[model samples]
Target chain A: MAQRAVKQERAVRTREALVQAAAEVFGELGFAGASVSKIADRAGLTLGAMYFHFKSKEELAREIVVTQPARVRPEHESEGLQHAIDITLTWAYGLAEDTVLYAGARLVMEQEQFNAPEENSHRQWTDIIACDLRAAQAGREVRRAVDVEAVARLVVNACTGAQMHSSIESGRADLPQRIEEMWRVVLPSVAVPSAVARLEFGQSRGRRV
Target chain B: MAQRAVKQERAVRTREALVQAAAEVFGELGFAGASVSKIADRAGLTLGAMYFHFKSKEELAREIVVTQPARVRPEHESEGLQHAIDITLTWAYGLAEDTVLYAGARLVMEQEQFNAPEENSHRQWTDIIACDLRAAQAGREVRRAVDVEAVARLVVNACTGAQMHSSIESGRADLPQRIEEMWRVVLPSVAVPSAVARLEFGQSRGRRV
Candidate 1:
């Protein structure tokens, strides 16, 4: 049991190191430019060890992309649920321009390093956010008229477009601030306006968005 | 006069070489990954000549970005006057993935690499479309209640998002078809239902949607 624990610890460390290196490589080189050799070099790992943990670069990238939502706080999640799905999505919007998030996103786009299965898996994970929005609409926290799938797709696209533009066009404005404002604006279209007002005024203190 | 003509010729060559090089580098390395040396090498030119013309990497990138809208066929100057403008802009909905337009847009986002005054030019271009939509509404070509600006932004965002995602996601699905269909569905909100019908049926004459 002690030996098993030791191996597990080593494996976790290796994985952390790999993820960190992925952010760096993807941040600088984008998904296409980053290679396994380069990422391994960045992480100070050998090819054999990288293979031991991850079957391929795609696996590592998907692992990172799938793991990104962990940054959302519990409070944010519950508040979003109370108000509507946009509020929850807004929380993740904060991470749009994050180096780690960008890298992980690029990895999903990096065709060579990963394959179709990995890409579809990431797409499925992305669809989860859309699913949540649809559920909120079904719950009547969001409007019934709007198409939740399209709105969810739009939300992700806006997040990505704004993130890329914000990163490359810095000094013009604060990205996080802009995103929050956008969320505030777009949220009304998807949200139950009364619910939002209630949350805004603290009328529904115990409610979920 | 001869010497001046020769100088102009050299300048044109340099300019073309720079655009071609920037496109190749930007396409593969992404905006952040590309450098002056990489572009210069790609163009088979010395760094000095590149600097002589562009002065900075940002300048070269901007030059490429500004020339991108020609692909749109200058809807503003079309022969159909205001009606043509509407048709032209509408036609562009299907051309969202045009390489030239995407490249130009990418350059605008890479504002750090192309800090020319026109860096935020896309905002105005988008506004131009919005204004045109408003004009159409005012002219009774559209519905009075539609939010022209919102729909314009939605269309632009949808196009850009589709392009970027499709480029990476391959089999990412056809967004233009979806977007065009969406317009048909949404037209009743802003445009006269008859106009929407005309858009669908080519207006009884030889006109085409």
Candidate 2:
């Protein structure tokens, strides 16, 4: 029983390593350019070991896309507009430093070519923001006239653009600042005046996810 | 003199056809995946003719990137925020139907891999928008406190993201609607109340670029 437990732990570690390496390769080379051998080599694992964990590159890419949303955790316990802001800021910071999340985003953008789930990540993000907006609306933090779906779509799409531009311009080191600028313009249009005054768009608020 | 004129016209036509074909191939296959032979074939021209016009694939991609901005023309003579809105909407609509424009945009997005000019397209766009915003600010079409640079960046990036998302989801058929939605959220924050009221977000306004 003790040996079995150790073996299970080892298996988990190997899988994690493989996913991390795959993310790096996919993030840098894209789906068409990335290869299994390169991913295995980057992970410091044998091809046989990689095959044991992920059957194919498509499965690995799918895993990255499906599992990305859970990686963005709020920095603290908050509700309404603050919660939404925290998530966006935290995601911006994470996208700068986390290779796995960055690769996952790239895959989501270029998924159509690989036959991976294209809308899963985008839809998940939209749903998360929409839910938070609904909460904000109920609490009177946002304007009564604001369309939650449109606001959510705007925020998500704006952030997506910010990330892509930052990546191209500065390798995403400036993503948080870009996102803050985006919110400054966006928040005023959606959130109520009172809520806007209370919301924070600082770097300190973006805790690691 | 007549013979020389005919030869010059033929040369001009060949160059135009090659650029158009290169745009289609590069737009669909991207820089790395595209081949000169394929571009020539798509243009219905011989390889010798293509070589006469473009020395290499890199030159072709660079030409596409450098010339993209000129393709986005305003639907009519307008100025201030109206002009800005027209450019964005016209660009969105043109991005849907113009293969040359679409390929140019893709090249700009993936310029790093091909050593193409990265900042030219973005900088040109930001400058054009900033100039309009400056005009708007002087005209009181834009709010007094709005940061022109930040707003320009936000607008350019948001449009970039919207175009990318629309391309993946609907082959860019919905890009105009998406940009209109973006402007609906963005203009309220940057433009003066009076300016926002007068801005047109209609498909008919987006003439062919």
Candidate 3:
């Protein structure tokens, strides 16, 4: 049991190192330009070690694209829909804790490498968000007539644009706050008034924290 | 006098030719990779002539960044806000414009180029859109108290995302219609109810028409 625990911890460490190194390489060289060898070199691991952790570079790229630990966790099903969005964005922000990740996200998003299943797995985010919308509507947390698919697409697009702007902006003071403000304006359209009140503390937009 | 007029027109033609060439080069090579000699070559102009018309490559980039002559004509102003949006989107679709512009716009928005007037000039598009939003609101075409700036930014982002998606999706039959539908939802927010009813007389989201 101890041996297995040690192995698991080592695997986590190696996986994290690979993710950090890959973010740097992908950010600098871009998705098309980055190579597995370069990422392996940056990670201070052999190519074989990388393959041990990930089946291929595409698998690594997809993990980076989704950037959400919750998706990998078994307990996501227990979290409420809004909580899930909040968790995913927080995870995305956490992945961006490495400064290189901020740039990597931009490069990957711009290049938009979609052929690989790992990279394309980012689509799961939209579907997840859409499912959340459906759940919200079913629970009377959202409006009945709201088109969940469109809302999901728009939410993804808006958050993407907002995140890109946050990273690229020169004097961004509290970008997360700014992004949350965007959510405030958009949420009321689909949200239960009670949820909005709870999130807003009963204050109007531009007034709430 | 006629000889001078002929010279001026010739100069104008050469200037326009260079702009088109610069845009093409920028499109193909991206801003960081594009150079003046290549642009001049594409324009079928001597390098010296290109230099004579534009002082430097950066100047040409700035010009291209701000120049949307197809959408920025005086007629755009006369059409009023809703019609201006229609004309602008029509021009985007008409040119079969590339989504590469979003990358260009992203670069322009970086604001990392310091406080140079030329660099700041790229913000003209944002300002122009904001102006349109204000006009739209003042005309009672949109809801009051809405954050026009945020919505304007969202509109720009949504359009960019759609353009990029359409480029990748080979059977782009309904992509243009999707864009139009996006506008339908957006424009109604700004126009008065009666006007919204008058303006919106099509399928809300026509499939790839």
Candidate 4:
């Protein structure tokens, strides 16, 4: 039993290494440009070992896309508007530092290359944001006049644009600033006047909890 | 002289056909995947004719990127906040109908594949929005406290995000609707109270003059 446990643990570690290497290659070279041998070499694993972990590059890409939001850490201790802001701020910083999220973002945009039939990430984000906005509305943090669903969708779309622009312009070094600006411009339409004044847009908010 | 004029007109027509064909190919296959021969064949022109108009694929891509904004038709008959709104509405429609703008938009996103360095489109967009906001401010159509540059950047970024999501989700069928939602969310921060009520977000606003 002890030997079996150790073997399973080794398999998990190898899978992780392959995931990280595949992310780096996919992030740099895109899905069509990336190759299995290149990913295995980058992971410092034998082809046989890599094959044992993932059957094909498409599987690896699907894994990355499906599991990416989890890897980016969307859970926040805060709730409502602040929660939504923190989630995006966290995402901006994550996109900057984490290869998995970066590659996942690229794959999400170029999803026509793969055959994953999952719910679109944009709708997923909209649903997440809408949930938070509903919470904010219950708490009186959000304005009654604001359309919760529309505001949520707008936030997701705006964040998508801001992150893309930041990546293209500054390699994402300015993503936090862009997110902060986005909230400032967007909050007036969604949040109550008092709530807007109290909410934070600091870069420190994005640091890992 | 008449014969010479006819030859010049034919040359102009051939160049236009080549540009249109190249845009379609680049839009569909991306810059790296596109071939000069394929572009010529799509245009129903010989390779020698294509070479006469464009020396290389890189040159064609550069031409597309440099000239896309002009092709998209940013010129607006209105002024102030309405003008800014009209410009975006027009763009949303242009992206849907104009192959050049559609391909130009793709090339702009994937520009690392080519080498053409002018001002970044985002900055150029920001400047255009700022100019419009300045005009709006001069007429008291924008709020006094609004930061024109920041708000302009926000609009550009939001539109970028909205257009991308629209493309991914519905093949841009809902782009005008998305842009309308963007304005509803963003206008409160930048436009004066009076101006906000008067703005239009119709899909018909995107139609040609």
Candidate number achieving the greatest DockQ relative to the actual structure: 4
- DockQ of candidate 3 (2 decimals): 0.29
Worst 10 residues of 1 chain B by lDDT: B200-209
Q: Per-residue lDDT tens digits of candidate 4, residues A1-209?
A: 99999999999999999999999999998898899999999999889999998999988988887786676554447889888888889888888778898998777666656743336677778888899999999999988888898888788877777776677778788888888888888888778899998787776667655
lDDT score, residue A2, model 4?
A: 100
Candidate 1 lDDT for residue B19: 82
**TM-score head-to-head 1 vs 4, winner:** 4
| Candidate 4 i-RMS | 2.2
**What docking grade applies to model 2?**
medium
Candidate with top lDDT is 2
Error of 4 at A121 (Å): 2.2
What lDDT would each prediction earn against the true structure?
A: 0.57, 0.83, 0.58, 0.82
Q: Please report the TM-score between candidate 1 and the true structure.
A: 0.66
Worst 10 residues of 1 chain A by lDDT: A200-209
What's chain A's TM-score in each predicted model? 0.74, 0.92, 0.71, 0.91
The fraction of correct interface contacts reproduced by each prediction comes to 0.14, 0.53, 0.12, 0.54
Give the CA lDDT, 0 to 100, for residue A95 in model 3. Answer: 36
Any residue pairs clashing in model 2, and if so which? Answer: none
Compose the digit string of candidate 1's lDDT tens values, residues A1-209: 99999999999999889888877887677666677899899999999988888877667776766666653432433433343333334344534445575665555444444555435423544476667766666677767777766665555655555554444446324445434444454565567777567444221221222
User: What's the TM for model 3?
Assistant: 0.76
Model 3 misses residue A173 by how many Å? Answer: 4.0
- The two-chain DockQ for each candidate, comma-separated, is 0.23, 0.57, 0.29, 0.58
